[model samples]
Target chain A: MRTRSVVAYKGPSGASVEIVKQTFSSARPKPARRVSFLAGLHGDELEGVYLCFLLVQYLRRLKETEPGAFLGEVNVYPAVNPQALCHGSRLWPFFSVDMNRLMGEPAGNSLPAGACRELLADLKGCSDLAVDLHSSNQHLAELPQIRIVKDFEKKLLPLALQCNVDVIWVHPMAGVFESTLGYNLNRAKVPTLVMELGICLRIHRDFCSQILDGAIHLLHHAGVLNSSRRPRGEIKMPLVLKADQVGLVQAKRAGLFAGRVKLGDRVGKGDKIGDVVDPVRGETLEEVVSPFKGTIFTLRELPLIYEGAPLVRVALDGPDER
Target chain B: MGEAVSLYKNVWEKGHFVDTLSIVAGLHGDHLNGLHLVSLLSRFLQDVEDGRLPGFRIAGKIQLFPMVNIQAVMEGERLWSFDNLDLDLAFPGSSCGELADRLCNVLYKHTADSNYALLLDASEKRCVSIPHIQLLQPDRSLRRAARYLAGEIPGGGPDRFPGLGIVRELQPTPAFQLRLYNQWIENNVCALVLAGGRSAGIDPETNGALLANVVNFMLAVGVLAHATRKAEKGEARFYSLENERRVSASHPGLFLPEARVGESLRQGRKLGELRDIYSGETLEELFAPQDGLLLTLRDYPLVYQNETVATLLVEKERRWYWPFS
Candidate 1:
């Protein structure tokens, strides 16, 4: 395994935009399949960027010690949108647009546009399986999850089970489709799995290790790795959830939220989730209660909340299949 | 004089639950026109609530967020204190995001479910304009209702306020107006923005006109009983997005304006002039791109290359003042 850098786009001001890809591969005859992992499409989502680097380190050791333990080709795009990363903005700076929204647009129109173009061109025909890693926005912390278009569930569900994430979210069809990297690659017959963990602009080592381990598990399941690095636990099928009105709990008051329940915590109906407190008077304004018997899928990291703002996302627990 | 009551307070009150109108103003600290308008409304609504105004029936609730950005308002700055970010562009803010983000989310939450929302906005010190209504397009009845309210204002003929109303196709980004537009689409809140005047100084006429216009809008939206004093729809100019042209300086120099806001211009007329700041030699004459109304004129001169000098409203659709329609 070694590191490689390619100039994805050159800015008008002569600054070269690059994508650093760490590749772990076998030197022998053609590997079984090519899988790629990408992170930092949004500059602020740094969790996946760190995860990719850590995975690269693990892969390097695996290739050095047990060469046959790892099979096939694995490429990691540690940071895709460097301009946004440098500015700590969610979208590509200067262009002031979400690069994720213009993936299928003609490149060379602008810097970020050109980078998206180069990204698609680089990954085309190279990846049989693709995973786009991301973190939730700075406001909300999310449970480790795998998301795929709802239609691809049957084909990708078994593979998703191997990711070791806590939840499997089916992508809602309401949002932009063709403009996203996962959708574009999926349309091209490339199975792309979008994974999200933790919060944006920060690094969580535990989450990163879990994600890295999940990737290894998925690769091993694909017959690409022969390592004895067994799955951390029984590869249980995740509770597949859809974003709906039922799961969303909005704040009833505008104040600082003092949370009583954390992410991944299970609660019964009518359980106290949090309470909004008026910081000036130090009085509890309203108590937020859970409406279902479920596990918290997403929790607010920043306490300041407004009336009707989503306080928590709960994924209802289903009937036991044990 | 031992104790005093604060004029700056969150005075949100509810009347009969006929309709809910969330009136938000002063999102930016320095843009005081909105604050002034809110102040006027607070007094008027207080009068109506106290039964002081005869025949003025308060039909619905008025949620007044007079000082949405209080810290910024105190500092007299356009942006919130969090990283000096513009609150106007921090829409659909997050519950767990930064201060600006949470404020934005608060606004979104309040306005998302309202029957109607009125956001008051103003430019910073660089520019100024007459009080006018700005509507997001793809044409909803809200645009027509705003035009109706603009017509109802006291002193205005067909082309009176110059760009009396504007129809903009707002991008669905982080902007406050855009966030409100999203609510309009999903919840039918009929969101409208009353963007008028500029910072550095306040115009009483613009403030009064805005105050009247908001009241007129309440009547038109069925939040108040129709009265003879209500503004009648009249001949006025509505500028589409294309008509609003922001003319920037082509070269760095001293800029001299040949025309001010509310002035009409013919095609190819000199809008401004640029001269060498040091040498006092004529450099360039900025001309109107087309026949139009000057909506916003830059007050603070001393120009830089690419600095906006003025915004003209061209390619307009003007409605004639038909007294007996």
Candidate 2:
């Protein structure tokens, strides 16, 4: 195992943002393939960072205990935006730029600019498969999910299935996806899968363990590891939920939102999902109801909400059940 | 039935095809001055609507949004409850973005057609400031109208509210007022921001003075059919944001202020002192950068490094009658 640091950018304070790459190689390597794992693109999303750290630890232990057990190489970029991570901000603190949108753009001297170039350069001609992990906003708690571009679903689904996530969401090759690092890497002939789970600024231990085990299993599937140990959890087919039927519950009036249902709770149509109460008067102003009978996938963790702000997101039941 | 209802919607409306003035307040929940000012204006307009004021027909419609950040108002906080975002900072917001974005988008759409927009705000808790108006890129007519209104309001003195109007070149951030200025500029709307009051409680006299200024502004802009007072003549001191002075803490500790709001200070005057909270040792002394009027003073005892302790309105070379010593 070896560690290297690639200088991403020089901050205004003269501090350089160096993306640390920790690589574990197989002893029996003879022109072996390489798979990359990246996390913390959004500074505040640290679940993937913790998961990558654990994965690196696991791979390092495996490499030391039994040499020649793996086939190729595993590269991990644990925290990409150091400046943002410092302030627990989702966007780069100085310029307030979103790193995800800087892919394929000119690398300026601003926040995330040099970092993007360094990352793209590292992925070029050096990686075979890539996994980009992220988390929802701080107010949102999401189920462990894998998102794949629509065009790459056929080629990436089997690999995504190994991750043991709760859902597999396929997004079209349009909008913000075109500028994402996963999409950029995919266009570079490297298949990349995006994984999202839990909340920002906080680590979900169970999800981290699940993703770590999934990464190990993915390595085995990619012929990197020859171990017989499979992914720990049962390989259940994640629900292939569509984007249209996802009911978004928004606030009708500004108030303190108190959700009646917790994450992963199954609710029927017209059920009271939550209540928006006036913070000053202590009176319930609005009662939010579930539009479709389904499981609550992402609920607002924060209590404050305004009119038109989404308070809950429910994964709807399929047409057959509806 | 003791049921609660949200009836404050569309509080005041009059006239059609005439110029519209959109007034919004409570972007931060603890900013009570603007909320009180608009509340009084709404009641006054409601009286007109009920025919209580005979032969007084408003030429234009007034849209009064009393509290934009309702959750913040209820919680008695500065930022919105969801994500703790400052509503003022979220402007020209995204439709599919977070809570603050959506709220800003909604507000923008509501006031998109107004000919004039006013943002009323107050100083944060643990701080106090003299009432002032901030104008961004004001033209000759807007400047004249603003000055006309400023002359009518009786501030704590001749140089308090309506007395200090600053013309800012641009906002440093993508603030709500900046966005409104941009939107209004595109549609030829005059946008102005009036900041006043303290964090603790509402001052009715200040609200009344502000209300008179608004009424006078409406008359000056041909929004009101009748003028109540004679045209008073006085100059409203205008300065650029670049000329303002800010004193920040060099050390984090309990802050003891030496000057009061609206007080004048010469160069080398001590502003405040930062001391160790537990040890009670003096950490650092803050001093004035120039001879200026103290517009804002830090009220909170505990302060962190780099936090603003006071803001001074630097004196200009061109001076008018001196009212305060």
Candidate 3:
């Protein structure tokens, strides 16, 4: 029910790195439920940082009137990537390496490796569930959703699906199983989930709200909030697919490009996706085609494409699913 | 030539130390995907396409390699270094620019008269939290076509990051090459630019997919292929990365991925999961936003929080029938 902070580590320059924790919990023995969420793993991703900002603003105010009225703990730390955030980059300030990929390695060995070792040690020592927030950048647009790998599915799914998001991905494989904070929670047998909002290099009010509301709804489901804030829609179980093949379609000859498809459109197995035209030559270079039967997900935005630059991505369907 | 662990040393270091989920492993000449792609593209024009495209077959090929950050690549460092100054902040590339700039100049010269699409392959040790495709063009139609092309790449969209790209740096480069691609050639070839895939090494499938996508896209446009035709492989739901998506992991943990590139996904889908290599604690879950495709999947096990796990490119719900299925 209160905010908590712990020094995660110290920069070589000696600036203390801290784990800013926002907790909402009740007093008595097993008085209520609790939820924890963290964001800004990539310092350059400022949206989650802002969403966490939005969360703290409201949550802090709610505490005053209710006075720990919620059932359990609701903790949030807005920014986790300190160095990268300061410089507007994706990696840690000095390392120039990504922080997200090192979850599986030992702490001291990773950049920001010493991150809140003391704090996580303690949270793991007590916490029950956790969630991480993220935003998508330019080029890709998507609906917000929750991701719950297998082990956590037992406790997390039924409860996680309560968020306003659209689908839930349940994976139980090994590749998805290593080196992540959420993976750590599931390993500890603590239920956890990750919420993904597409593209946030800048803020999109709708996308931001989708993420914020989903988080709040999750809080309600977890019993962290005592009051009822009705969710807009029901969270559906996921419809999973395994992307099998990937390749690039190039321009046979150089020329101006005329794209025929839009994002999120369903394309037939052999539909015309676009065309290459020699502007001055007054002729068509080639007919860009769809290689498979699936939704057309993306296209290379640049018109002047090389002979082999990627043009569009086709999501292959299950042979029988179609 | 390498120790057992050195097969993917750069990736190992990045994956284990930097927290990079997936790595693009490039050995010696393999860093030439761009040239190879461009060459492949040049070859297909006369051989593959049945005379749909009208142009002189062999006038010239431009290799605009204007910027080669050899110091950075060799040292596993970022910020193109010359006598020892960073060049990313310094652009329009100087004629006498050292290391990176000179490399850029040389690159520009190679493609100085390319007369066609410009393909630039950039690989290094740096990674960003929010990743995207940087498109440069002044022409609206060209921009439109590229924007459509940009769709296949994740993170750069209207609802996403706003800027067109890290400043349109290609106009001059391509113009420089445009002159070259057109020199002595009856029909001038346009320049195409591309970068971004797993770094530190190579992901063959990702490379192949990126290549194949480009091929098919060209076919769709009627510039390369005589007709647009679907492959026998059926439709695939490749995960287009959510806006500028990057995978991250906590410190001091062994990172791993549960998903591979080109995997099908549903919203809330688990593309991969991570756990503590030592204690076996579950750390993170890499998921998909909606019914979409998976582009680049992580190949390594260890990770850091901000590292790119795998770019999970997603798409709207659709189904393609595979022969086996």
Candidate 4:
């Protein structure tokens, strides 16, 4: 096990922040393949942090118990934006800028941009494949899933299937995704997979364990770990989804939303999914319904919602599924 | 369909011309300074068109979009309340998208043929600023045009308005790719952002100075025939990203500002102090690193460690010409 600082910044008050990465590799001079795990890109997303912790613990145990099991290298970046993670903010506290958005940007005088440049340069060719883990914001709770842009769909779908997520969604690309770490890595031929699970600021142990198993399975499949060390269990096959096979439900009025459906519930069309009640007026302002027969992949976890706020996202399971 | 965003444009033209200048404001609902300045310019243009003003008259076409994001302004929010979408970042927008997107598309198309586009905006944070001009990746010709609009000779000194003296050349980042200024620049139009004041509030003196600056720019660019008053002159300062010194708080606490924006300060000047939220003891005091002009100061009290409390534009020595040296 080796730990190194990827980037460091000294503040005006004599304090400093550094992004560190831990590497575990075989005793041999060269490894078969190198795999990287990135988490805590957004400071509030804690699921990936916990998942990384679990993976690191497992790797330490495997390295001690079965030294021959490690055939390749595994790198874990537990927290990329340490300042934001410490402050529990979604953005870099100083500039109030989203560090994730600054990835792949040209190096600049700003600390955030400079840090991103260094991080990208370090991670560019360091691994044969990488996984960037994330969790939804405070407003929404997402089920375990992997979202891939359509341009990289063919190259990423097989790898994404290796992870035990609920759905593998291939959606059309938007301009905003061009600057993301996963998109840039994939563009650079590093084959990075973006995994989004659970919600921000909270950890779901079951989900973390599920992803931990999937990560180990991926390492074994990539020849980074011995087959004998693979977790004993059937890896769930995630449902493949396309952009059109998703339905979004939004609140029609501003009020407190009481969700009637769980995160992984299946419902029929026109089913009652939630109710937006106006507590002040003592009236149910909106009775949100499922737009299509599908499984709920994302639900509004926070009760206070404004008009036009997304309440739920459903992955259609019938004819829409391909 | 969502509620339609009505964009009102007031144009002043006296004769046929090949060049047209487009001025846009109110892209963000909270940027009321720009809105007020645009309104003042609109009324002034109307007077000139009606031959009510003594010396000024329309020479070329001048298009004034006083309020672009009407819904946001009505709600007193920075972004559209319904969608929470920033209209400023929806440039070259899609007609088939949301309300903000459609509005951006219409505005982009409407100003596609403009020779010069000026955007009126304010600080993105909860702070105030002195009226200044911001250029994003400006080319040589655009820089010269900006100087002319600022009422200064191509490389000469003595700016027309000290209130709008600061000119900051910004490097476009990924976040700026969707800005209207970037889109216009890509399309070969000279674009400039005239920003100052605070969001969601009005400063009479600042808006008045901004209005004067716009009028002078119009005169300099030949959009307006003549100037109504003598141009005010002062030395304009140009700064790049390197010239910016951002002072951040070292502790999380309630920040109490000791200085105001636009004030010139010496090195080690106290900018603010962070006080413990519960005990009310001074946690740390922030100071300016160099002699510079304060461009922005944090207005909101609550701040976390490493949060920027104030931004200063460092003053640099003027380059010595060969003969002068």
Each prediction's DockQ? 0.05, 0.09, 0.01, 0.14
- Least well predicted 10-residue stretch by lDDT in candidate 3 chain B: B1-10
Candidate achieving the largest lDDT: 4
Model 3: per-residue lDDT, tens digit, A1-322?
4556654544422245566777655644574665667787767566678888888877777777665556776677777776667776665665554455444444433334446344445457556777777654333344455666655667877766666664455555443235456676667766767766555466657656766777777777666676643455654443333324322345555555688886556677678989987777677878988767765444555565434445665544545423
Model 2, residue A268: distance off in Å is 13
* DockQ-based CAPRI category assigned to the predicted complex of candidate 3: incorrect
List where candidate 4 sits over 4 angstroms from the true fold: A318-322, B1-116, B121-148, B152-170, B184-190, B195-207, B218-325
Candidate 1, residues A37-142, lDDT tens digits: the string is 9999889999998998887888888888888775688888888888788888777664446677777764423345556777887777568898999998866898
Worst 10 residues of 4 chain B by lDDT: B316-325
What overall lDDT goes with each candidate model? 0.71, 0.72, 0.48, 0.80
i-RMS for every candidate: 10.5, 11.3, 18.4, 7.3
- Residues B1-325, model 2: lDDT tens digits: 1223221335344556788788888878888888888888888777777778775556677788888888788888776655646576566567776656766777887787787888787764567887777766777766665575564356556345434443333332212233445665656678777776687468898788767777767655655655354333335666656567778765667889987777778898998888876677888899999998887788877664455678887866433422221
Model 3, position B183, has a per-residue lDDT of 25
Q: Best to worst by TM-score, what's the order?
A: 4, 2, 1, 3
The CAPRI category of model 1 is incorrect
Assign candidate 4 its CAPRI class: incorrect
* CAPRI category for model 2: incorrect
Candidate 3 scores a C-alpha RMSD against the true structure in Å of 23.1
Residue pairs in clash, model 1: B29-B73, B152-B231
